[model samples]
Target: MVGVSVLEDNLKDESLILGLLDRHPIGVAAVFKRKIVFASKGLARLFGWRREEMIGRSTRIFFSDRASWEAFGERLYRLLEERDDVVLEWPLQKKDGSPIICEIITRRLRPLGDDWIVLSTIRDITAEKRSLRRLKARSSSLRLELSGALEALRREKDFLRRIIDLVPAGIGVWGPKGPVLKNELLRGLLGENIPREIPHLVGRLIRGAGRVFRFEEEIQGRHLLFTLSPIDDQNILLVVEDLTSCVKMREGLETLAQAKASHLLSQERLALMGRLLAGLTHEINTPLTFMKTNIQIFGAYVEGLRRLLEGAELAGEKRKTIDKIISEIRDITKSLEMGAERIAEIITSVKNLGRKESFNEEIDLGQALHEALILTHNKIKHHLRVFINGEPYNRQKGVPLLGVYTTGRRSLLVQMMVILINNAAEAAQRRRVKGATLEINVEDIYPRVVLTFRDNCGGVPEEELSRIFESFYSTKEEGTGLGLYILKEIVNSLEGTLEVECPKEPEGLLFRIVLSGGGGGVERIFNKTFYKGVQDGHQGIGTG
Candidate 1:
């Protein structure tokens, strides 16, 4: 009886242990012959079921599919045979037909009532598994991208190396340690022997990368120009070029330019001297004209006084002595007047050769030409008879020039006219023909004032005509060759045109000057008579 009581106590202890396993917080279950005989409350909760509902259910009921249940069983049995316990991740289901991933640990238990028992501990691991799957997929994608990037980088590096190698200029790339890349051109420059201090030179170049560095060195008996530039913090590039041929060509060009510039400066200085002479003559002639006129008046007064003294009744001796004195006084006054007139004429000739106009103002073409003729009278009066060939007068356009008015720097036009008149005079003197004439015609031709100078001088050669307007080109002895050239320039600056008609039908040269002004436009005076009451004998004009 005591033995039976001890056996009952052992049974009681076994029951107590089983009860504790059923109430565990984790899902703990005891399976006998693949059937659930005991299930913990935790296990029932994990499957969304009551403990009593799972107690008598087949373990297959907890698997989502028959294939999964059989596969898990096979794996569990194989693993259990090798070890005391096996853990597996599986899709578990509940009574409500919902699914979850679970971590299941199965261990072999002692045989109970002739059936083998397997104890299993189950926990939901769905969240961790899903995260793990995502992480694995991301890692695989990243690995593929990295592989492609690495291949593309290698191809680009190879292509860049090939291109840099083919360039004609010597190229070298230096890294922190030393030269990392170099082209064939650089190798040729270095030749069979490399410099010992090249590494130091590269180091200095890298440190001074903020600015460019240049050094000259003789290699293979050829002068080489080396330039160093920075690529980045740790890399620098060096380029070498040969400039021996280019330097010779540049020096030759510079020498030629200097010679041409010197010739131009000489011509310019000569022209300036001519202009200065013209200005000095004009300034002197203005005052000299009054001086000559006053002297002439004083001579006339002396003559009148002599006559009055001669009319007086006096003794023979007194009359003879007084008359001699009066005669001497008259001769002296006449000589003084002649000297003044000569001075005026000399100044007028110089004036035409040296003056420049500084500012523009409205001027009447007729009056301007008339004044120019007076100033150049001494130069042309003997060889040429000149006249304006137009109507008597027009108050608005200035008399004899009828309806011709223009705006320009007055002194420039006057000086140009003087040059043209003097040229005509010279041409006539060369002809040696008496009564050689030059005619000036001013016309208002629709928004322009046209001044034509026609002379009876023998024409210039056809070949020479083309070059007459060029500076330093002359057709006469003592000619400066700047007259026509300067005239052309002034006309151009005034927005005017100058043209020549050489060897025209009448056997004379004609110069035409067109300036931009004729009473605003021709339409303004369309109905007005251009040359009213004109007369004859006003044909050719000339320059001395």
Candidate 2:
């Protein structure tokens, strides 16, 4: 009875341990002679088999090949003998023939049998193996990306260094300890002798001492503009630009401008002198004309008197007295003739003074007159009423004048018109003529074009009229009395004449200009008339 109870107790303990092993999370199995004798539900589920189907099956069925299965069994058994337990990770096959990785923990068991058995705990580690493989692939990808980024960064650093070296402006980085980086330009500017003050300047710049330090300094006889800019807490950028050429160029330009201004002033003075000389010459010509004419008449009369006295038959004393008187009269006549001839030479010289000799060119006198009128529009536009007769040229309207062409200096003609128009304006203003009318007529008379300037300003007194051509004889408050004198000289220069008529009849004062005409042909384009306060905002200018 005692033996039977002991054996039953032993059987009960074995059954309880087997129940706990079957309920574990991992697969459990017992193998004997390469055949599965016991298999937990977990092991059967892992192999996609039922417990009943796997329990009696050979372990070889779970292996893809017989050699691998045998090798695993032998390794497991040999390792289990040396250690308490043997662990192995192996490639295995499921019941459906799919490959998997498994971790098997095994121990050798000696039961009441001659054959050896192994109790194994298996866990399917396939998911964990796949995760590990993915992690390894990601590590490789990250390594490649890191290598490419490092190469790109190196290239960028090299490109920036090359740019700094090649720039024209001197560039340097200065820190508290002085220059930390210097480009080629900066090195050349510094040369072998760096100033002792540079380190102090750099120290001040690094501490943010001022807004921007910029000044000029001479280095090696070359003027340079140095600028220091703060870059960071400990460093600053120093830049230098050469300004020697710019200063020299500016000085040269100033000197040239001054010389040009002086030349212009000299030219203007010469022009004024020429105008005065021309007026003086005209004043002298008028007196010479009358002197020559009267002298010739008086000479003829003296000859007639001498002939009559000789034929009358007088006594000795009376005849002697008469002959002496006749001789005195002849001497007086000879003196007058010689004096007039001497004055004539002086008049010729004054006329040609400061006058530039130029070849005559053909120009439309009417056109030149129009240009002069436009230039003097401000002087006459508001004060006087002006009317022009003839085919007038309007530059704005593209209308040209007729056959009023003349062979002369256009500049001289234009100047003459300016003087006449201004004189007329002054006269009108002086006389205070209401509804003042100044008429201008340009007519082509075959070989000559006659231009007339008539003004309704009160006529000059008879005494003043004769002296109008005299220099320094003016009727105006501001006049230098050279206007009419200059006008006469201009006419004479062109081989033309200026005539005046003042009878107070149809017009107040009449002045005529006659010029020789020469051009290819004649084209009578348009006629224009201008009146004061009539055509406002109109550009065409004319007077009749």
Candidate 3:
């Protein structure tokens, strides 16, 4: 009673202590006199027992297979032996027969004269242990999934990019907004001025445009065929294809086609038209011939009438003069009779072009070639050198390549040849090399005429070679790009095939045309059926 001792009074009452223990998630246990005496609510729950069940039980009993926790028991006993107060951590058992690791603080209680007791407070770390285990498992799973996604994406992207890079044409993708471009392989084509921000680029792309357009555009000094398509009606995806080389090819093909077209026109307008012209002009010739003869007869009749009039006047007066006038009329009747010749010859020749006859002629491919050469002579006269080999030498070489048509349309054959020769000429010109010459070889292959046209002006680029027959593709400024395409049309129409070969050995373009010389065929009509073909338009082609 000398002073109020803090050790004797329990200001932290049972309720307060229980409340504090309940607030903590860690398991707690207490050991008294070196035995398990009490445990917090959490510890009891972890051990699958009520607090009363464990209050008097030894700490050793908490281990399911008691030997498993013997290490921790040894640690506890050593701590108790060293001092009355000890702080320790160890593994114990849970209700599920699993280990619950814990840390504990043990203190000696000396109250009411010589009675010594050990109070051990334990904190269960099982929740933390489970959390750390879950965390480790989740981390491992996430790592594996992310790694798989990354690896799959890497492989697929690499494969796609390799294919794109192999393509000669530069390919790119722009988002719906447009200035932002995403192209794995085409970035190299963009070169120096690539944008740092994709969003900014995308904003710039669709800034003003409303509709997608596919057309040629020169952007940043690069010629491109910008094919724009709005993906999902919001994003404008543009493909910028470089077409500087294509345009050049068209100009060269156009030049050759123009010449061949000129030759066909000249032939139609000149020698072939002469006979038809003679017939059309016969309207004036037949009428004029009859008119001339009648005039001559009238002159002779006038002289006789004049003489008769003079004699009648000399007979002096009435009755004699009337009779002489009547006799003059008889001679005039004879003059009119001689002028009634037929007008039949003039009508015969006028109907020549409308003849329903078809041409089944043994079409000399060589002769057509010669005519075409003569016609396009000016195209190659000054700037080109031409050589011919393997032409039919002797009469035996004529394989009788005969073509028959029940319908009269021989003119299309000429047109077909014109197309072929013109394309060759254009290819030659586009090559534009010094001392460039075109060489032709004609060989008879039984059922076909094998004509190979080659030029020393250099071959077409490998990239443009396949699309040489595509319409509207051109590398030249003034090219319509329809020359070789039309030539192909004409050849195919005549049941023939045209193939282009680029010789790696000689490094020039060699075009081989195999013609089936049987019948001018049904293909010569210039009507609706003949003109309608596959969607191929007459555009830029002629390289191949």
- Rank candidates, lDDT, best first: 2, 1, 3
Q: In model 1, which range of ten residues has the least summed lDDT?
A: 535-544
Off by over 4 Å in 3: 1-362, 390-410, 424-432, 518-544
TM-score of each: 0.39, 0.31, 0.30
Question: Candidate 3 residues 1-544, lDDT tens each?
Answer: 1111322242224444454444334455544443554467767766677877676666766666667567765776677666765666677776567777766665554442443354455556556566967644543343333222322233244323332332234544455534443354356556645433433434444575444455565546666665444433234444556666767788788976986787678668766676666666576667767775766677677667667766654544665765566567656655444322212222332332233435554454444444455445556655566665733222112112212222113444555555655655666676665776667776655555667787666677899899878765664568766667766776666667789978876677788877664333334322222233213331111100
**What are the per-residue Cα lDDT tens digits for candidate 2 across 1-544?**
3222322333345444444445544577777776777777768778888877876678888889999999997887778668756768999999899998888877665543565666677767787677967644543343333223322223244323333443346766667876766767778876765666667777776676774677787788877877766666666666676678877889888977875686578669978887887877777788789989999999999999999988998999999999999999999998888778656644543343335645497666655766666656566866666667734333333223344678877667877887888878877777777777777887778677788988877778887788888755688878766678878888899899888878576447788989887434343322232222135443333322
Model 1 global lDDT (CA atoms, 0 to 1): 0.67
Q: Backbone clashes per model, in order? A: 17, 6, 24
| CA shift of 494, model 2, Å | 0.4
Cα lDDT tens digits, model 1, 432-452, are: 857777888887776888889
Task: Mark the regions of model 1 whose C-alpha exceeds 4 Å error after superposition.
Answer: 1-311, 315-358, 390-404, 430-435, 461-464, 472-481, 520-544
Scored by Cα lDDT, where does model 2 land?
0.68
Output the worst ten-in-a-row residue range by lDDT, candidate 3: 535-544
C-alpha RMSD of each candidate structure in angstroms: 30.0, 36.4, 27.5
**Full-model lDDT for every candidate:** 0.67, 0.68, 0.53
